[model samples]
Target chain A: MTLVLFVQHLANGLITGGLYALVAIGLSLIYGVLRIINFAHGEIFAVGAYVGFFLWRVLGVPLPLAFVGAMVGTAAMGVAAERLVFRPLRFADPLNSMISAIGLSFLLQNLILQVGGAEPRRLDPFMSGVLLVGPIALPLQYLFILGLAGVLIAAIEVYLRRAWNGLALRASSQDLGTAALMGVSIDRLARVTFAAASALAAAAGVLVGSVFLLQPTMGVSMAAKCFVVVILGGVGNLPGAIVGGLVLGVAESLAVAYVSTALRDVVAFVVLIVALLFRPQGLLRGA
Target chain B: MLALDRVTAVYTGRAVLHEVSLRVAPGEIVAMIGANGSGKSTTLKVITGGLRPVGGQVLLDGEPLEALAPEAVVGRGIALVPEGRRVFPRLTVVENLRIGAYSRADRNRYREDAARVFELFPVLAQRARQEAGTLSGGEQQMLAIGRALMARPRWLLLDEPSLGLAPKVIDVVWDAIQKINADGLAVLLVEQKAFAALQLAARAYVLENGRIVAEGPSATLAADPRVKQAYLSF
Candidate 1:
């Protein structure tokens, strides 16, 4: 591949990788606290994109406002889901929770399909422009996505590092029962973690939706990518997720350019499997 | 002050605590001494709000604690340094201390309390940036106790703090507990280490198979013929 094309693909990969990190971070946080892999996580991401699309279409809200709305609204839905479904199942077996989450995922997907139809809906970018650097071209929208992800990740990292609530969250992840005895409100922490994760997924969805068409099934692909990132990053390790995402993103982008566009998703999975085979804990660390 | 009035609890329909009653008055150290399955830890769980009592009430300052959540119960000034020295393994010593103050929103006092915890557990202060999991068992126990103290609780509920530590470490921990009580925080200590627990407590209760078999002044209970023959067999 030409150097120009490779550089172009690298930019594309980093943006996608950053988004993957955002999504995986949420998944890791929820899994950390509740110890259940939320099957509906992808659907939550999809719902976020839909929310952003609808807000832009029906309410004529600005892109920024719609993005926030989508995140907040999805987070609200996440909180409601935790309260109505997951919270009740706390005493139930972990397998039961996993099943319930899967059921919820299908339920949300069908609900969206029934209401919005199966058509791939388009959302115009709020700004359409291109920037050119030495032998490389960049889209302003891609830069926005990267910037947004950076700010959000930075904010979350700060809160997790400095806040008491963040410490409680970490403690819950380490051991739920022990955390409770230490005076952490486990239920509340679970809800908040769910909400935060949902919100991140929502934001990622909205950012990506502006660039790509939104469909009910769009989340499945990202979900697959997110899983790859999670595996590559390692379970319960946040930094690993970020690194995994970027690695997957860059690898996938390069494969699309140098190898074949059709092998784009394949590259990520292969990398993930290899990462698992070599370092099952992940590329960075383990829980 | 904390009081458990006929508190009963069950896990998965099998009862673990049956009508367990205990009390820790302000500034006093109360110990629950028993064998492995004697419901001492369950009693601590009941008081800490980790397990809701199936029957009767947990009262803090005469208010029924059954209605409050675990963290809220902490907000009401009760903290439990649970069994097994359950310090957050991945967290640094300082982070563990900060988490202890989860119920407090006052930033200024939180800093002061953290400094005080460091003062109490100087080892923790030395390893403030170290991950808690890497510490030795005795050090982890100190961190757990230090973490509980960061809450600035009126009543500190310690479940078997000296369970796995050596006698010297136990002495170090008990000294800290005694110093904590001297600083006016009431303590509810549950331990299978009957002799060490009784030495620290003002009043002590003997638990057997989920029931309190005897209750008296710490020294008297420690000297009881039954206690002497059973738990304190030295």
Candidate 2:
């Protein structure tokens, strides 16, 4: 491939990886504290897209408001899922909770399919036009995705480090029984985690829906890739999820560019296998 | 003041503590000494709300702590420096200290509590930025106590504070515990080192096979023939 084409593919990979990071970080956060793999996380992402679509198209809300609406709406769904589905299963085995998540995922997808139909739906671009930096032509939408993801991730990092509740959340993740002794309410922390993770996933969903298209099955592939990113990064590590997402994104982009499109979906699994073999602890050691 | 009134705790349908009763009056340092699997730790768990009693009640200042969660128990001014010095391993010392104040409503008092902790363990102050996992075992134990102190607790529960420490370090820990008790905070300590616990506590209880076999003033217990024969061997 030409140098310009390679750079273009690199940019595409980074942007796509940003989306993956957003999704995977949420998954990792829930898993870290709650110790349950949220199989329904991808469905939450899809729900965000539909929420954003309806808010923008049907309600004629502004783009930013619609984005917020999607996030808030999906966050409510997340809180509901935790209270209604996961809360009762809190003390059960991890496998039982994970199976419940899978069941919830299927239920969500079927619900979406019945309401929105099987056809893929598209949203109007949140931005338009392109900017050229040297020989590379960069789309504005990609820039928006990169900018938004950067802001949200930075905010989360800040909250985890500096805020009191965030510190409690981090502490709870490290040692639950001790954290409780320290006066960190595990129930409230779990609810906050679900809401935050769901919001991030919703943001990714809206961004991806605008750039590409949304369908009931979109979450399946997205969830698969996110799980790969989480495990490759480290199961419960936050920074690991971001790095894992970018690496997978860039690798997949390079695979599509230098090899064939058929190699795109296979790249993450290959990396996952390689990571499990050599660094089962994770690419990052701990949270 | 904290009291366990005939608290009987079970694990997997088997009783671990059989109607254990204990109390820590204000400004008192009380110790519970026992052998392995003797349910001393289980007794601490019952007080901290880590485990529910199958029978009887835990009371704080004569108020029932029956329905309170662990954090709520902390809010009522009870903090547990749990066994194993379970600090947030990845967090900085200061961060871990701050988390101890997680349920506190007064931000200024939290700051003051942090200052008091730093004063109590100056070593923690010097290495405030270091990850807790990097601290020496003794330092980790100090951090664990310091973290509990940050909650501004009226009563403290310490489990095996001297579990793995050098003699000099254990002295430092004992001194800190005594100093904190001098500040009017009641303490309930559980220790495997029965002799040291008896030396430090004003009163002590001997637990064997999940029952309190002996309870009296520490000095009297230490001088008792059976207590000396069973626990004070060189």
Candidate 3:
């Protein structure tokens, strides 16, 4: 293959990799704090996409505002999930929560199907045209995804490092009982964590919807890939999720480029199997 | 006063604490000495609202402290330095201290309290930016106690401060506890090491099988023949 072709795939890889990182980071935060895997996380993404779609297409809101609205909408959804499903089940069997999340996942998907209909809808791209440099041509939409994702990821890192609530979240993840002793409002933090996680997932949904089909079922595969990313990054590890998302994204992009386009989704399963078999401790150190 | 009046605690299906009564008056150091599984930590759990009591009242100055979350307990001016020196390992020393001040309604005292913590354990100031996990065991214990002090607590409850530490380290911790108590903050020091516990406190309670077997002034309990034969023999 030509070097130009390789570079195009690399850019494409980064674009999709950025989206995966966004979703995985949310999954990691929720799992890190609560020690619960939200199977409905992908469905939260679908909710975000639809929220954005509704705001922009139906209400004629601006695209950027639509993105913000989607985040807010999904954050509320996260809070509800925390208060209604996760919190009551906090002391219950972890399996019960997972099953509850699965139930939530199915419920959201069907609700979307009922409201939006089974037909796939398209979210118009905010920018048209490509950025040309030497032999490399990157679509402006893809570049927007890369830049926005970078900004969002950096913001999350800074918050975790510098913010009061963020430090409490990190501390609670390490030792919940000690955090309680320190006067951390565990229930409040859990709700906040859930809202933040949902918001991040929703942001991903909006970003992906900009350039791809906004289908009710799109989150199913995207979430499976995010699960792979979370596993690769180490469960509940933030930095791991970032790295794992990019790795999976690039691996899938290369698979599509060098192998077959059909293998793009299957690559995540392969990576999941390999990661589980070889490094179940995760690729990072946190959890 | 911080008091447990006929407190009963159950773990799983078994009652671990049965009608156990104890009290710590303002600015008084009260020691609770017990063997392993004698419900020493359970008492802390109930006081902090980690375990909801099946019976009895936990009172802070005669205000009911039942069903309150651990954060509310701290707001009411009581804090616990739990066993095992559980400093949030990945967080830096300063971050751990900040968490201690999280529930403070008076936002202004945080810096003052933090300065006092650093004074109490100067090594913590030296390791301010380092992650807690990288510190030695002794330093971790100091950080744990220092972390609690950041809240400007009126009553500090310690659970086995001497667990897995050298004698020298224990001395440093005890010295800090005495200094903290001298500052007019009440301390309820729980320990398996009766020698240090009895020496530091004005009064002591002996816990056995989740019941208060004997309690009196520290000197009186220290001289008791039953206390010498059973507890101090260790």
**What do the candidate models score in CA lDDT, each in turn?**
0.85, 0.91, 0.90
Clashes of each: 0, 0, 0
Among all windows of ten consecutive residues in candidate 3 chain B, which has the lowest summed lDDT?
Answer: B105-114
Per-residue lDDT of B1-234 in model 2, one digit per residue for the tens? 688889888998899999888889989999999888999988888777778898998988899996778778889988889889999998999898889888788843676788889899999989989999999999999999998888888999999999989999999999999999999999999999999999899999999988999999999999999888888875
State the lDDT of candidate 3 residue by residue for A68-172, as single tens digits.
999998999899989998899999999999999999999999999998888888788878898998878888989988999999999999999877788889999
DockQ of each: 0.67, 0.87, 0.83
Greater-TM-score candidate between 1 and 3: 3
Q: What are the chain A TM-scores of the candidates, in order?
A: 0.96, 0.98, 0.97
TM-score of 1: 0.93
Q: Itemize residue pairs with steric clashes in candidate 1.
A: none
Model 1 misplaced stretches (Cα beyond 4 Å): B8-19, B54-56, B105-108
Write the residue-wise lDDT of candidate 1 on B1-234 in tens digits.
678899888977888887877777899988889898888877876776668877989888888998676667778888888888888999998888888777776743677888888788888788989999899999999999988888788888888888778989888898999999999989888888789788888899999988889998999997789988899985
After TM-score superposition, the amount by which residue B115's alpha carbon in candidate 3 deviates from its true location, in angstroms, is 2.7
Second chain TM-score, each model? 0.95, 0.97, 0.97
- lDDT (10s digit) by residue, model 1, range A1-287: 37788788889999999999899899888887788788889899999999998898889988789999999999999999999889989988999899999899989999889877899987777577888886577988899889989999988888788766777788888887777766677778878898999999999888888888788987788888888888888887888888888999899888988889999879977997788789997887844
Q: Please report the TM-score between candidate 2 and the true structure.
A: 0.97
